[model samples]
Target: MIPRVPRLQVTELVLDNCRSSNGEIEGLNDSFKELQFLSMANVELTSLAKLPTLSKLRKLELSDNVISGGLEVLAERCPNLTYLNLSGNKIKDLGTVEALQNLKNLKSLDLFNCEITNLEDYRDSIFELLQQITYLDGFDQEDNEAPDSEDDDDEGDEDDDDDENEAGPPGEYEEDDDEDDGASDLGEGEEEEEVGLSYLMKEEIQDEEDDDDYVEGGDEEEEAEGVRGEKRKREPEDEGEEEED
Candidate 1:
């Protein structure tokens, strides 16, 4: 049956995994003038040239697609877009960050598991240009897939009882068996590496007059050593995340 477009009332549109190759975005424009959310994840679209025209779009997700379109087009078009997810694509360089300057209202950006090799390259200044954005996933990777759910939404208590029987008893967390890094304590004696070299200086010298060159150099050396140790620990976690990707 051919689906007729109703009067522009669509607030959310999801075409995920549609295997759509052509840019049929124009079809929706005629019927979805009020569209507030749009998703074409894992679909076969490459650019955001057609989307910026959607003046009412608030959230857009086009991840896992082969998009090489310059970030300039996205920034120019979706000026009002607040949430954007472009991870799992081939967007590598930080030029996109520059293009996103027009997205002054953007609140969240997900470039996680992407081609950004070192976050330090765009950590403070470039990212800060997006003043409205509060959260950004620098890793360029695909997000976790949610588990399956039964679609029988109108079931009554009888169905609940039947489901209970079919699913068996309730499950519980195996808390005792799940001990890894362990929780960090933050009370009286909570001095870890986060305390920094300043902690050692204050402990040894009670007054400000004791800031000797030897003590200052020692603090600098220890701080550098501590930073290296932290980086070493972080590298392994990054590798694990890569494996998960």
Candidate 2:
């Protein structure tokens, strides 16, 4: 329980891996008036309710929570929040993302291991929706591959044109080629090369994910272990006093 001081001056609070649930932190607002930075990561929170509305709050870390609703509440209650970490949640709704559009000052947002990250063009859509977000899921928009370079597009178009010239009613090219079999053979070889290049280009576009999305969830277990280790540490005096008694 937070002590009822005359005027609370506490600013930073780190309550990571506390096994906290919904509504458990509702009473904090009544105590901590000047609170700013808050970290409640891995707390098993399913809903973001009753969060203290400290307008001075600039950073919030609710990572690994089971938050499925109340994103709008955070955006509304903490309008001044600049950094938010919601990684490892099961937030599947895009509307939750739309809710964050109100956070005009939000600079960094982490949504790693969340279901929303699996959607098609997920990062692009989020980037378009939240222009103020500088870093998203541990990456910047600049890191994504360009749709297609101008040179690649020009080469693709040229290849398509060559294929179109070679492709016609089945016998049309054959009739033209009968007069000069050698020339026709050469043309066919070039057509094959063009088709092969076009196929490769298509493959490259499909492989765009290889360049765009970088998975980095390998250290999650280590982070959880660190949090647990912190929770298990005992005060040296408390441990030794029992032995003396």
Candidate 3:
């Protein structure tokens, strides 16, 4: 069955791992004239001789292909391309990649798992050749934008230390505990003093009752003495009256 093709403007095309060759790209014809993004990864591509001319191409992913050369062709054809993924290819030499320096607007390049990635100082060499690249092998290798993981870790540790400092020391908690204990003890002492004062007041009340009883006994004795003296004076008056009669 003939497949139905959409009657729309094609801006992006992806044929990853489709076992496509240069013939498939060549057959794209003018239908993809406005294509800005293309991905043909793992498609066994060996050359760019018959690749369609995509003047407005901005990103290309040709990773995992058998492409050993022709980076210059891509740079010349896709001058406006900014991002390229050529990882996992048969690129054995940096010489082929040096040709991509012509892509003045190139910002990101991925050469991971490629033969050229094994070369010593390979990243430095690439950065030297492609000064405009901001990312290499999926990592930001730009001088100013490079991430300092160690510095970030140190800053995190310093922040943790600052938090601990703000929480104060263990000694302060111990001092607070001591102060609370002292206050509790002082309250207990005040309660004991109050109890003692109450006991003393009870004893004072008992002593006042005993003193009142002694004063009552003394008044009764004085009354008895006055009655006895009056009886003696009356007996003497009776003896005088009998003698007068």
**CA-lDDT, candidates in order:** 0.67, 0.78, 0.82
lDDT of 1 by residue, 129-236 (tens): 666666666321233332221123335656889988886665533453244224333332356554756787777776655668669989999999999999999999
Listed per model in order, the count of residue pairs whose N, CA or C atoms clash below 3 Å is: 7, 0, 0
Looking at candidate 1, the ten consecutive residues that score lowest on lDDT are 141-150
- By lDDT, the best candidate is 3
Error of model 1, residue 241, in angstroms: 99
Tell me the TM-score of each prediction against the true structure: 0.50, 0.54, 0.54
TM-score of 2: 0.54
Q: What does the lDDT read for residue 202 in candidate 2?
A: 92
Worst window of 10 by summed lDDT in candidate 3: 142-151
Pairs that collide, model 1: 112-139, 112-140, 112-141, 113-139, 113-140, 113-141, 114-140
- Sorted on TM-score, best first, the list reads 3, 2, 1
Candidate 3 C-alpha lDDT tens digits along 1-245: 98765624778888887886442354565457788888988888888776666788888998888888888887767788878999988898878998898998888888988999889989898888899988887676654543334346779999999988998975778878899999999999999999999999999999999999999999999999999999999999999999999
